[model samples]
Target: MKNLIIIGARGFGREVYDLAKQCSGYNTEYIIKGFLDDKSDALDGFENYPEIISSVEEYKIEENDVFVCALGSIKWKIYYTELILSNGAKFMNLIHPSTILNTNAVVGVGLIVFMNSNISNDCIIGDFVTIQGYVGLGHDTRIDKWSHLSAYSFTGGFVVLEEKVLLNTRATILPHVTVRKGATVGASSLVIKNVKEGTTVFGIPAKILNF
Candidate 1:
């Protein structure tokens, strides 16, 4: 069995640890080894967590090691994962057993799907995309690489989320809406239209934030 190493050790990483236990092939297929974090004290107060193996820069790729990113920040998620990928590190997809993934859906590598997320028919999820707990995606929704859907986020049919886009907690995107690359939909926001690249939208109708 391969050893799975989680890249972050904070809140999201800790939560991923719990989710990993419920994955389909926990002990038989792969076993969790430890966490990789820059800060040594990231799990200082946490009980019953795997130890931080080393700083990201200090970790040497091992033969039995596979990785997964649990960082919440989109920028850091991309940067650190890419850094590890540069070293030819292999990654594993972590999908909670309770998630509903359609057989017609196409998923890329290094995906993290939390429990109860429903991925509908023909949904295309790109590399390293994260779907947090209770997220619901409608039919033909497309999410590009490194995008993050926070807890309780929902998207209607044909919604397109471009690379690195972040949908905060409870954000909802209407049918046929497109959120462009690097855009952020704030918590509890409703998106009824296309969002521009690199902008942040918030409020009931998700107006672009001025500052």
Candidate 2:
């Protein structure tokens, strides 16, 4: 079993830690190795689990030590992921035992999928994407690299989420609606139309509030 290091030490990091524990018994492939954070503030409540390491910039890379970015921000994920990759660190993909991916779905490397999430038939998930628990991706949907779909978010069939797009918690995308790169859909919003690049949408019909 490979030693797993989870980046960031907050809520998502704790969740990822638990998920990794579950993955161990599910597949017997990884051993949890605590967390990596810049400070000890986030490690306060997690006292039982010692702060085993620091950021990728300072930590020495072990032969079999692998990592996963447990951050919610796609931008931060990209920044740290690039740093770690450039430092010769290998990343690991974490898929919960309860998650379901259709046979026709094509997933890329370094994916982090949480419990009860479903990737439907013909869906293409790109590298380093994070799908929070209970996310539902319909058939033929394409989520480009470094994107995130928060918990309870729903995507209809043929939907396209470009790279770095973020679908906030419980957001719903109508069928065939395409969200462009770096765009964000606000929590609980209903996207009835296509979203342009780098825009942020909110409210019932998901109006573009910022660009």
Candidate 3:
């Protein structure tokens, strides 16, 4: 089994551990090497099992070891992923067993696909991305690195979600729509056109709001 290290000890990190444990296939394939977190307080309860490993600088990566960033925020996820990669650690994509991916889809490393999510044919999911529960990506869609798709979100065919984009719960993107980097689509919004970078859109039809 390959050694697997998870970054971030709280929040999403804890969720990843739960998911990994629940998914028998992932646990059997990799030995969890504990987590890396700056918050030493978070390590108190988890000291026994999984064996929490501290600093990123202190981590010694072997040839058979792989790392996963369990951070929820897109920026920190990308930052720490790069840090681990620079230290010769390979990133592993964690996909829940309940999720479905088409044969023609391409998913990059370090992605987190939560339970009940679906990636349709010809879709491309980039590295270090987090796709939450019940999200659906239509055929020919492209989701860039560090993007977050919240629960129950839907993206139609040929849609492009740029890096660091956040699609909130139940948001719907029409076919051929483009959501630029760092843009945020609020809950239950409908996206039909291209969204500008670093902007926040809300309500039906997704009107731009001051981010």
| Best-matching candidate per lDDT | 1
TM-score for candidate 3, residues paired by index: 0.93
Which sections of candidate 3 miss by over 4 Å?
Answer: 43-49
Select the stronger candidate by TM-score from 2 and 3: 2
Model 2 residue-pair collision total? 0
Candidate 1, residue 105: the lDDT equals 98
| TM-scores for all predictions | 0.98, 0.95, 0.93
Clashes of each: 0, 0, 0
Model-by-model lDDT, in order?
0.95, 0.89, 0.86
Model 2 Cα shift for residue 198 (angstroms):
0.5
Order the numbered candidates by TM-score, best leading.
1, 2, 3
The residue-by-residue lDDT of candidate 1 on 86-186, one tens digit each, is 99999999999889989699999999999999999999999999999999999999999999999999999999999999999999999999999999999
Clashing pairs in 2: none
Of 1 and 2, the candidate ahead on TM-score is: 1
Q: Residues 1-211, candidate 2, lDDT per residue (tens digit)? A: 6888888888888888888877734237667776888765777755556464776679888877888999888888999889888988898889988999897999998899999999999999999999999999999999999999999999999999999999999999999999999999999999999999999999999998944
Q: Candidate 3: deviation at residue 6, Å?
A: 0.8
Q: Which number leads on TM-score?
A: 1
**Least lDDT summed over 10 consecutive residues: which range in candidate 3?**
43-52
lDDT of 3 at 53: 80
